[model samples]
Target chain A: MTDNKYAFFIGCLIPYRELAYEISARRIAKKLGIKLITMPDANCCGLPIDPVNHEMSIALAARNLCIAEDMGLNIITLCNGCFATLTKTNKQLKKDRELRQRVNKYLADISLEFKGSIEVKHFIEILAEDVGIEKLSELVTKPFNDLKVAEHYGCHFLRPHKYLETENPENPTVLTKLIELTGATVVDYLDESECCGGTVLGIDPNIPLSLARDKLKNIKEAGAEAIITICPNCHMIYDLNQPRIEKTFSETYGLPVLHYPQLLGLAMGITPEELALDELRVKADKVLSRLVEEIKVKH
Target chain B: MSNEVKTYRKPLRIDPEFKNLVLKMPGGETLKICFQCGTCTSSCPIAQIIDTYRPNQLMRLAQFGLKDKVLSSKTIWLCAACATCVDRCPQGVEMASVLRVLKNLAVKEGCVPRVFKDFGSAILKTGFVYNIPKTRTKKREDAGLPPLSKTKIEDIKKLAEKTGFIDTIKGEESDDRQ
Candidate 1:
């Protein structure tokens, strides 16, 4: 009855590498009075080979979307790649009669159909629009005002650019604003919109890593206390591979990265243990613990 | 057409942006062999759509260390991730994927030219990732769309889990923030 029940589209990354993010999302949603439903049968948003296989990607995203339509529910997704790919495909299929006809022809064999009932959304927009930042502010029990953070937006999530209208894609601040609402200072960095070289990692890793090195260097140089990410793939390279990248370069750029969910959860007073901030590949170690102590001491 | 030919300087140099972008590919080390044999030029759909690129020139910049030129070239943005060029390359370079990597670089560099954000957000709300149906798409036939395979949230979640898709999804929320 409009009472905040959201279907949590965990996608792929958090359950495995960034499980902390999932924990954070759930905990934060609970605090905000919005229920995140982790439904069964939620398969891939079918974003595999999205850059290459349009039809295949659409079909896969469609399959996911179709299920939600069947449920008569609105979906709130966590990954920008899945969010962008699924929504873009649906919009294209819906608006372009010809493309839709072709996609539908492919779908008929699989028994899947595109019903626009499913509204693909980034958690930020929903949080901003549906949940509202004002409400978010109300939920903030402890803001980490001492922390300095940089926001990184992955390519699939926002670059092709006209789809996710929550902010100006070029200089987006949705995450920064959300973080700011938590009383933290948004750190500035020249390479904030930099790529994580995600697509290249699966195929030829060197090219991707080399690309990632550029941004990692910038975030480190920016003196950011932490780097916040919105996509799982981006987190993997930046959060998990930063060590490997530094090793390859014969240097060290030890920076802690957090998913938006985790950051929000932390600020909302969710305990570090409950949010599982300790589970990341890069390890929160001194980062969160120290931040927590600082807060506790200040209080 | 004949009169305009006179205004064309012997040959307008290749887009400066493409030149540099070619050098920026993470390990885009082999980008130099492409001499615009007119083969890629003849095959590109983007070139057909927009007259701003020549695959040959773009290939040339890859070899010359023109990183910014290549990255900023409209050519990189125009690419639709089609594998035709990769298939056509005599050097066996995975051009499509390479360009995609470059495009990803471009996006990171602030090249979200248009329509990418809205489309992404739309899919997040509904599982479809797009405007498959406006409200409650109960009947596929109603929208002249194909009936979809009935999938459960768990099925998609598993697929996402198998692919480590959660990181990708959550990252989007974090990355796109202001």
Candidate 2:
């Protein structure tokens, strides 16, 4: 129940596709003194199958909430999809008695119930709200003042403002502010609030590729050294699929996409190997080399 | 002998009760308030790239009780559910949720996409959507991470069955005649 402790809800995509996010998040959490208990029994946040059955999605999210409630701790998710689904379902189930009864009926079969006791949050929220920028700045032993990076605040993180209510969906500042905490300049780019189109990549690959291409094009044009992201799905679209987008569009955008934790971990003086920076698809050598050269000159 | 002209097209059938049914769904309450301002379409990231998928047009179709057209269109599956439209809509229509309702109805009509079926089957067998490979699970330990918590599959299956998710995924409720 302590503010620093959380039940880490490692959603499906992180384990299957984006281990770098999980690795760096863990490394940074350790350095920050935050305790992350793993929710091994957590199921998918129910977003992937939401189109087939809405009520089922609610039920699945409620089951995970029940687990967190049982542990008597709040939940922290690495993926925006999970954050959105669990937070929204938690809020809805708490407010709507009828909906709660319906979802609880499904939970009853599994011997679980949605008590609506705990809250769900994304990692960014934890750092911004609980850890605070002031304290985070003090931990930055090696600031990236020389680096400039653009941020992708994947849609689910802030949209459906009624459900999330975290920030302005149209012009969110949380990710940009968090990026600045690393002492890196947050470059302004066109369509900064656009969705990375990761959700529909399963349905039609071409459309998401086009959407990601536009984002990369804008960021490259804006003169950002790299693109920073928080969501694993967004990371997959921009980082893992960057080369594919380059090929499909006949464009060269060798932009390195860093998970926010990797960026923050570097500033916190965590080694690249520990943060798993090499695991990234697009090489971050340009950014890392600049940091090394800066340190060498300083010494 | 060549004077005979032939035309083949089924007359459009509008179901008056379709709108009510949609309204009864969780996210479909605001269906009647949409004035067709085209804001949702313009706000949509997917619609910008794909001219064929327009949220406003879908809203109009649903409003007109074009149940078959609204449910059967491939464009309904194209929504990323980013909810940009939901935030921007002056009517407060919750376009993403409305689209989800349409998608659910489409699946009920046996129009489930191949990928969703794979995701559903994966969740049924494993708790996660994409099955975490054994090598990756082993790699977690090497990376100084704890082993992933094992899911109680029996509990998950019981919940899935209670929610009728099993029937939906199995397509048992689908009318084969369609």
Please give, for residues A212-272, the per-residue lDDT of candidate 2 as tens digits. Answer: 9999999999999899999999999999999999999999999999999999888877899
Q: TM-score winner among the candidates? A: 2
- Residues B1-178, candidate 2: write the lDDT tens digits: 0011112145656999999999999999988899999999898899899877888888888988979877877788889999989999998998899889988888888887777777888988888889888999887878988888888899888877887788778874322212
- Cα error, residue B55 of model 1, in Å, equals 7.2
Cα deviation of B111 in candidate 2 (Å)? 0.7
Each candidate's interface RMSD: 14.1, 2.0
Angstrom error of the Cα, residue B51, model 1: value is 23
Residue-wise C-alpha lDDT for candidate 1, range B1-178, written one tens digit per residue = 1222244455434444554554454324446555545666565544553455566665555455455555555555445433345545667555654565565555545554334443333334433334444332343243232233333444334333433333333333212211
Question: How many angstroms is residue A20 displaced in model 2 relative to the true structure, after the best TM-score fit?
Answer: 0.8
Estimate, for each residue in A1-299, the C-alpha lDDT of model 1 and write its tens digit. Answer: 23476555666544435555655666666676777665445555756444422344556666666666776666777777677767777677667787667656665655667767656677777777788888788877667756777788775666445444445555776777787887767778864655565644433466457766777777778878778887877888887888888889887777888888887877777777777676576776545653443443232
